[model samples]
Target: MDRRTALKHSALIALLGIIDVKKLFAASGNNSEIRGFHKFNLGKLELRVITDGHILMKPVQPNFAPGISSTVVEKTLDANFASKSEVDLSINILVVQSASRTILIDTGCGANFGKDSGWLTENLVHAGIKPSEVTDVVISHAHPDHIGGLTDKDGQVTFPNARVYLSRIEHDFWMSNSPDFSKSKITDEGLKKMVVAVARKNITALKPQLHLFEDRAEILDCIRIKLAPGHTPGHCVVQVFSGQESLYHVADLVHSQVLVFEHPEWGFEGDTDFELAVKSRRKILNELALSRALVFSYHLPWPGLGHVKKQGEGFEWIQQPTVLPD
Candidate 1:
């Protein structure tokens, strides 16, 4: 080959080497997978957020935005560069270690949900925690995803050594013989009934070690339960305070960062009381935004820790950068 041609080829190869290989692979539909667990410290408290994987859900479902127009939903999703037809919903399980006690905020979907889910146990192992080592299992609500991992397929408690703490109102609501399904806004009546049944069974199985607490009760030294009902009759949020630092676990208060934060008025099908859900979401988000408090959401994304900021009439979720331990 001529010297000029060889120089030109060398320049082209150097240019290709300088280009971002990951970006090129992403353009070709390849991307790196998200890790299953993340850890960060809150003063003296050690917090670990574990992923149970994610599922792709259709955004056009009947109750996704009950009375909202498709045009508005599509525009909001498009603006965020999210999938127009589907949304990726993640399941986050929090593990808190304080004063020699290991606590779990909510269990993830077990073998029952689907193939994509049920990674909580595996991730827990990866985090160097065993089910038997968990001292307490604090449930925010009795939803299928949160309570499904309470027991195994053989109907035995998964956390054999842990005492389960759940809200009194939540336990009663699920155990009630006649739950007021008429008030539910879910479009699929069948799904609503199935969820109720599963919640009831899961709680019943854990009754032996169950310790129900009322609203605003301190379950542990630094952990307190705040009643935030709406998604369910007794849905609650768990707050962990260590010294002056605090981390709020906002469970299912906002499903999608784009849809819920950008448009809090939109109704979610999973919420039994749609209007109340909106009210609770706005009230809590306003407080968090005003206080600039750190938050750990169950469905926002992997690690789900961030701060809420007020934007126009709505709010915005600013995810915390992942920082691994040294």
Candidate 2:
């Protein structure tokens, strides 16, 4: 080989080795725990997060402003210490394991969305659950983050032995042949492909194992599905109850922790019905604060277990730290 080319290759290898070393050391320290998982027991109910990771999306101006002033929107974002008009949304999947059933609230981004997600399966296994052992897969909505993990990398069912549950309205909206599909706010073709793939595998078309429930249907003994739409046509949140203790899984009810909680009126472009979404957010936030029920949010930071506290006209979210099992 030519001397110059050989030396260049050696230098490249050395540089790569250095990068790897840095990453290894960082990972061994705090980096590996980036997407954390935590578990809590409310009497007999055990609720946990199988973290799927997070993403930074370019903030669309429509959802941020709508009727509000740009100054107000930008000021709110700035007040929250965010920049670049970028919002970081953390994704966490809820795992509810009890004496009666093993339920997963949302599937999370499947294997193909990129590196930021598709970790739910691994975390599930780590949490001492086999994919087949998941008895019920309850979807909060049909959004990608909530339903992506329905199929695995090979386009196979991730929870092969589980009964899939979803809101009938959510199922109908995505499967509708209406031209309104062209007007969807998010214009990503990948998203459309995902919707179509989901249509092909629509729970209705699957085994009788798939059941469609209307709003406010009780899925099992202590779990009730409540419709909290406006984010989508059929978005529903799952609430788990055991005696007096309860955990509310508010899926995508709020995306950006700051944008949703601090500026409750600000637009969230991800929602199909932006105006309606804001209304739903306000209502849900009010209920959450008043009810004092512990909430498990799908897009909140890892181990997204926390409560909403009333702050003036709006509210603030404070995530509870890990509660070590006794």
Candidate 3:
């Protein structure tokens, strides 16, 4: 079946991180949408997982796990009991409410991608938050899926009331007259150009509200941006703290909870610096496993709240159970 046909035929709730979908399970009404948004609490802060939906990449060999063949990827998938053909990349956006601030870690794909992937805005409302109520937007990087929702087609900022924060390195990399992709494995020049166009547009629109922070800078009282690089020169992860509790928002550190966790050296073709990404992944994964801190993944399964653990050769993602507040 074709990609759309396959997706339409499949029930992807199980397809966890830019993940794995086994079989087709048709849906009715708001059920699928209801599945798109999840809520819970982290210490004194309230958090929400609002997905912009997902991206389906078929015959994942070339587009993902860049250095390996589809045959190799299939073997790994087969061993893990996941689908051996494609992936439904989850686009999980995090919303944080702390005392005086309502923050969004990464804006969803918006309409830049398509209908199936721009669910962030409405899902935000259903989750009882409004775009205008978002006081801050902490961008992990400038990928289309992460920043596309920042502005409308008319190039106007969507979250009018929010001040946007991005790592200074990330800001400069994309804003530079010539953003380099020499190290990227992405062979499609069109897609690369689109990346440039989309990034510059939304970033330029965010200029007035944009605040550039240095690596390891704590933009908020409880949230700090840490440099992770590799996927993009400026790509970074976020750390959220509450009292003694903390959660790491590891954005695109690895796209798949399976492929990446199983093999930190593998990466999607779009990685700006695949080798660098691998090094960063190994370094950060080590730290996370050692820290045993709670984590939130931008592309992991719903809610994307989990913990990291050392397994055989690599680490594993241990998802936390959702708990409702009294």
Candidate 4:
């Protein structure tokens, strides 16, 4: 972490100190105030989870049935106090401020996607952050929700000066071919409609900022990108370090908190490769549980901050404690 990033981070949180958490949640209404983030200190580095919005989707199908009984899913939801059937997969964007740079882990679905989605920008501004001030934009994958905010409504670059980093596979998968939506089970028209906000032409032109990176590439001094593929071809997780303390920004390694942990093998129709996604999910979950490092899950309740733990034949996620244990 550098001095400049440190200063910006402190200023942003100090800004949030003025806003009441209850009032922020209340303003969100039915969307469920999932946009506000939780901030944690890693020695000198400051980590804040800025929520974009959420996805209310039906479970991934017959797999969502027997593999993890709806009964268990429902019970888990009840225990977590989350709404049943339609799960709210919250989208969280991470802003890491170290001594060197202010980096955003993944840009959330920008302001134009859906009424419920695309709140990242607004929330960032609310945190007293300017888009232009973001030094590096590290993309976990090229999925619409993760990358749609890369540009604005006018088809212009969203982060004009920031150097955008993405995995080689992720960039190729989305930019190269016309995705075969037929196999996706999602209607072609529907897929087209979903991507209408961020068409190919707009993405093609803004080529300079999007730099393809390989595994272990250091985006900044303390932040390193790891290729945790499967959710998307080049899906990734960013590891942030300051002294001995670290946090992993586990992007899309898990979607619905219940679905991913309780039944790691279940396929999400949204994932490009279902089998590989399961493999990646299980691998990451195991590693997370063992490491016991604080993790920032993009879609695991508001603020999306927690740690994974080993459970009966699987693993359980425990939210990060609000206060350090004495």
Tens digit per residue, CA lDDT, model 1, 1-326: 86445434443443233432112111222222222357778899998887776666775545467677888888988899876787667788899998789999989877667877777776787668998999999999988888889987677788999999999998988898877656557767688788987898888888889999999999679889999988988899899989998999999898889988988888587887778889999999999999999999998766688999999999999998764322
Once fitted onto the true fold, the runs of candidate 3 whose alpha carbons sit more than 4 angstroms away are 1-36, 323-326
lDDT of 3 by residue, 197-265 (tens): 898999999899999999889877889888998999889989998888888999999777788898787
Q: Following a full C-alpha superposition, what root-mean-square deviation does model 2 have from the true structure?
A: 8.6
- Cα RMSD for candidates in order: 8.0, 8.6, 5.9, 7.8
Candidate 4 regions with alpha-carbon error over 4 angstroms:
1-37, 59-82, 180-189, 192-202, 323-326
> What lDDT does the true structure give each of the candidates?
0.80, 0.72, 0.81, 0.70
Tens-digit per-residue lDDT, 19-114, candidate 2: 221121112233332223566687788877766766657653654445567777787778877663776567777788888789988888787568
Candidate ordering by lDDT (highest first) = 3, 1, 2, 4
- Clashing residue pairs, backbone N/CA/C < 3 A, model 4: 1-98, 1-99, 1-100, 2-98, 2-99, 2-100
Q: Cα RMSD for candidate 1?
A: 8.0
> What TM-score, to 2 decimals, does candidate 2 have?
0.82
Q: Which is superior by TM-score, 2 or 3? A: 3
lDDT value for model 2:
0.72
Error of 2 at 323 (Å): 4.8
Model 4 scores what on Cα lDDT?
A: 0.70
Stretches off by above 4 angstroms in model 2 are: 1-36, 59-70, 179-184, 187-196, 199-208, 323-326
| Per-residue lDDT of model 4, residues 106-224, tens digit only | 77776555777777777787666888888888888777788878876666777787888878776666666675434332334665556633535435745887788898888677778
